[model samples]
Target: MVSFLSCATQTHSLKPRAIITSALPYANGEIHLGHVASTYLPADVTTRFLKMNGVEAYYVCASDDFGTPILIQAEKEKKTPQEYVAHWNKRDYDDFTAFDICFDFFYRTSSPENIQFVRYVFEKLKQNGHIYETEIIQFYCKNDQKFLPDRYVVGVCPYCKAVDQYSDLCEKCGRVPEEIENPKCAICGQPPTKEKTTHYFFRLKNFGDQLTKWLEENEHLQKDVKKYVQNWISSGLIDWDITRDITWGVPIPGDESKVFYGWFDNHLAYISTVMKFLGDKGIDGREFWNSADIYHFIGKDIVYHHYLFLPAMRLGINQEYKLPDYIPTRGHLTLQSKKISKSRNWYIGLRDFLSHYPADYLRYYLVSINPYSQDDLNFDWDDFATRINSELIANVGNLVNRALGFTKKTFGTIPEPDDLDEKDKDAEMKIKTLLSEMTPLMEQNHLDRALKKVMEFSIYFNQYFQHKEPWKKGPGTNSCVYLSVNAVHAIALALSPFLPQSAQKIWVQLGMPGKTTDHPWSAISEIAIQPGHVLGEIAPIFVRVEDADIKARKEELGTK
Candidate 1:
């Protein structure tokens, strides 16, 4: 429930400018419904709304191209790590384009600029004494002469005696290896020995008090998000291990033997992407860089990493580099009421999903049922079909098609209504209020409700159509006719952000002059389509998706 006064007004304006970052997709796999619902969809909607509201905003994202996964993937594919990332980077770009996510910059961490910038940040952190080399006794097998991460080695759980417990934790007994009295390497059944190695660690614990103070003061953050952050702060932060035992990452600048840690490097992609876009804009990347208004959209799992480690990196570099002004995080997206597991092969691929349904429909569905700050949201196909078919096709689509169809068939052009009644005025004012109210929420990444607000505009328009009965009156004399035309103008403009292509279709079909993108922000409340306008040929904006089509696609993917 958004307050009425929270609606936009000339006096209470949104910030004139801002920068936003959606967590970079790790370049390991194709994006899934979970990725869309958790981060991309929200970020896309927010960026669109910002552009519509005439705000100077830029969205930045890149592929996380470096890390152990890249190396592991390269080995699996029998390709060089560089070759592997190069192939997937193009795939990711194609996926993003298909989804219509208008990121100003889509960069890759493998870029020379990114590596240089990442190393610079790492160097500064090291110089500031925020990072240090340390080591602990870790399991190693002499036969391989390699350090074994918990996943590589497995052994029987001492307590439950369940065989093949992962080296770090026993799934059956629910105890970590530290709790096990004796363990054998599951690989060779050889006794494990502790060997020490030094690595870089981020002083996350050092900034605990400052992070606590910052969270307490930022009240716009959702209650659930605040609670999550509070829990992390309450337990006290751990100095995050920022170095890894990998070779593919940005090599630690001076220490070629070590590489920039994944946690340390991945989050820096946000800033790195921005610099890549700035590309010597001469505005002093630092000037815009340290600005206080930074928004980060991410999933709940990575909250502390983004909120704490990200800001800490900035703080460790320049105390003045602004902390994230807003962090709008979402819970996970589940498939069939289960967590989307890449290992289990139970995730919804974006490309596969789009093959059956249009991107707007998928975008609309994800936004409609988004869990902005709570737990995971379920993406049941039945729920998906019902929402898009009912809300989108039935309600919003029906309103536009009916109004445009009636206007064209009856008059062959839009006819201005001579007289207006109370209902018409009320509906127009309500639309004004709705459009005004939604801008801020979209800017703040409250996209779930913001989209609902967008849908309600169509709801009201449909309600007005039914009440006014525009079909009953003669073209020139009907007051509802003009009112309906004006109503469609508002609807089209407001819907533009959510469904740009569909909105453009509505705009063109209405015979509005100029491009839909040229439509001003003011047109949402003030009608831009004039009376007595000759519209172009009517086009079907969205085709109904069929069960057979979806089923066939599901079968191809081996989804139940």
Candidate 2:
């Protein structure tokens, strides 16, 4: 067995190298804030933090372009699935980039390379006898001439005997609809016939023991998530259907009669996409795909599929395919305190939002108020405006602008503050303590609190500035000026991760050169901004949102 923690570097003390993946965005439609909250933004923060902390991390994601859903959507729109995916893929990529998501590889499921890789795994499982052909009776609507998937069929429930329950499964009884005595197609109200068809099933029950052991050792999974999965495994992991009667997915290796199940095939997409990118770059990508510390970022809804069957498939392959290191699941995002639904047109577009607010502002607000552990976070225009105006603009933005503005105006340069007097000494101590606490908080993924610390430090600096009254007291000698510059530099370093663009703005304005991002986080306290440095013009770090601007966006979102 390949130990996950075997790789170690002399300089890096941490065990294991990591490859992070956000849940692949479906190649169906435009992504909304809910999509960003669930996978993109949170995953980006994790990757950014890890890279900032000196971890060797690669972020991978792709478009889930294959599936009946995509086909169905394409038929409705009178366009080919390729055409559909192409349009949305471009749109989604643009949105993610605009939001500053740093994905190492934005992959697609439709690539021929992905097809080859997926087929290779299928052959491996078949050779191992982990796949079996089975004929099962499933509902078929003759009028539509299409076999109804679990979700597509609907009829009267058998257990509770509720009317119009799903034909494949009854939600009321929570039992398979094949057990239902009598059923009718909800779409046509026609009695459906049970037909036998040949299909393949994954040997999920074979890995029950292995899965149980994996869960037992990895106690980092949240209690609720673990319990839900454990309950499913305890009930039994039946041989999952691995072949679908569809033309939309990867065809079964040598079997012209079947195609690999869309869901099962999609899971292999992450690795395949990586291969495609690496193959394009003329590099062998197998080194990373077969073995790397891969972390999957997903929502709770897909936990079961990812945790059990997905890894089980890999482990069954009897190779060095990497298992997910961590699954950082997040809850849903609500817009205007209500669920964002397409029918209601409540979803806000990223392009529209970016037109008015800066990317950093959105990143700052999302990270600051994220329900990281659990629970839904609400996004209201009023709250967004307030947080930006009061916190970013009034506190973080105001303090940076004022300090630099004062230095530029009074001294014709950025000044560092001198050694603190009694009161000043106490404030400096408090700021240092806050920084000390923030490092670990960020390490633990307590981003909300880390953001709060940023705000707290901002408030502290404001109070310190007001008390010192550098503008009124005249340029505080050379030492005093040096001390002030040092303080501002430390604050800029702290805010870099959350407000990277704005932090870079301050980084340049303070007359500091080089890429702001290359600086080590640990050096935040060193205060590198030198005294006697000629400062650039102090532009508005963050502009206050007016009520009219907020109202216009709110109305636009309402009609979206």
Candidate 3:
């Protein structure tokens, strides 16, 4: 079994520290469901699970504040880049918190610490013969009178032939083209002219052999993602242009006219932010980072950056920082069978979703549908309501309410189980077995599968409750109540990582003293709730997701 325990055990062979990071949300816009589905939520869940299992895991993220998109948006809004990013940074963190993404330190890429670190890394790479300056012809907009960088220029992807892609990244094919084809100024909507300028480049091609060896040796990375990464390596690596003609980014050490590219500085924030947090506590962040297990959670769209640019930079700097041990990559979330486009108003904002529904409802539904792979997942309103109503409310919620509600009304406390009957013994054994089955799945980052296993356990107990018919006051009534309530306790622990708020509600409903996460994950396997333990207030943990509300939401999106 590929259990988290097993992974932890191996890491514990050295130390039990872990650092989890989600892809930084660009500070130019509000976070939408698509943003969380593939990265933030999964990272949060994994971090929570690791903490529950006694791992010293810290989840950190920063707002990507130095991209061309931010600069353009700031200019259009008539606000300085700092003021613009400040507003969205707070706003994005608030939205993420609303969705229960518990980031330990939410910093920004534009912070002084990151700027200094970026410059430090640049100097180190320069000394190590990995940084060089070269003159190249860059797109310069005649109308805008500025050199276009990244989001400022739009063109067809040279490799994939996808139209209207950013010059730096092609979202359609997830490749970073060496140069875009038929480039135009995004601001003026006219073909851009070329101008020669000297810019700094990272010797990404130099680390090709090292990266291939790392990709082949790191078994923790997804096989599917590794396959493509290896293929990209085989196709001849290209040196990355590390400097951009922008004023809002980390300044190149001696050159104030140009700054480090957003990708160059943004990812280094991962290290700078964590080090800032640890430095305040008198901890050696470098020692800790090098020793801990690291995970970088990202969507498939940025695979080229995370897989190539990120590791290669670390390797170039004499491995001052270690590369991520696991990159949990997932596919984009499409809405209603179409691409979710912010410009088209075809997306659901995280805050907007929470206004109409509980966070756990969204959390549960997203994780239940999302698999541990790059295969795209669709979020249809009809499908969302069906899963919440039939699966969450009907299956898991039904079992919890039925079990706890009956126990509160009839016994006013947990009843002593009668001597173990065959069925009772089987149910008890199943709870233990389910935890064993789920451990490896969670460890393997198969959160979708692990959550489904928990739901299936709920189904099994619901059936067991139906078969025993505790309402009939039969001879097995006390035993059924006893086992069922214990099952609710187990379910809450199992569900804690996915549906945390709902799990806490279950913990309170069961009259448990502390948070569900306060108990070790292994406690789920035991019948920890004893007889004579008075039940807390018994109320339904989840309300059925109404079709009318869902319909209104769909209509708001201009869908029929």
Best by lDDT: 3
Q: What is the lDDT of candidate 3?
A: 0.90
Q: Which scores higher on TM-score, 2 or 3?
A: 3
Q: Write the per-residue lDDT of candidate 1 for residues 1-560, one digit (tens) a residue.
A: 11011122221445655687888888888988788787877877766666555656678788889865578778989999888988888888789779877777788888888888888887788889888877766677776566655455676775567776764456543333433445556446777777887777778788877777877887767777677667766866667666555677888766787677666777777877777677555555655766626788888767657767787778788764577877888887878787677877888788877776778888888888885675678887767777877888888778778887887888887666665568767876875676667767765667778778877777877887887776667433355666666677777777776777788888888888665556555567775556677877776677776677656655654343
User: What TM-score does candidate 2 reach?
Assistant: 0.88
State which candidate has the highest TM-score.
3
Misplaced by over 4 Å in model 3 are 1-15, 558-560
Candidate 1 all-Cα RMSD: 5.1
Q: Write the number of the candidate with greater TM-score, choosing between 1 and 3.
A: 3
TM-score for candidate 1, residues paired by index:
0.88
**lDDT of each model, Cα atoms only?**
0.72, 0.73, 0.90
Model 1 backbone overlap count: 1
Prediction 2 global C-alpha lDDT: 0.73
Clashing pairs in 3: 2-440, 3-440, 4-443
Give the alpha carbon lDDT tens digit for every residue of 1-560 in model 2: 01112122212333334577888888988777888877788777766656655665667778888766787889999999889998888888888888888778787878787788888898899889898888888778898787765445666675567876654445443343334456666456677887988888889889988888788777556666777677777977667887777677788877866677766877788778766766776866777665555678887656767888788998889755767766777777789988787767888877777878899988888888785565668888899989989888998778777777777777897555565577666655654575566777765557788878878877877877776676556543444455555666777777776667888898888877764556666656564566567877788877788999988887787674
Q: Select the stronger candidate by lDDT from 1 and 2.
A: 2
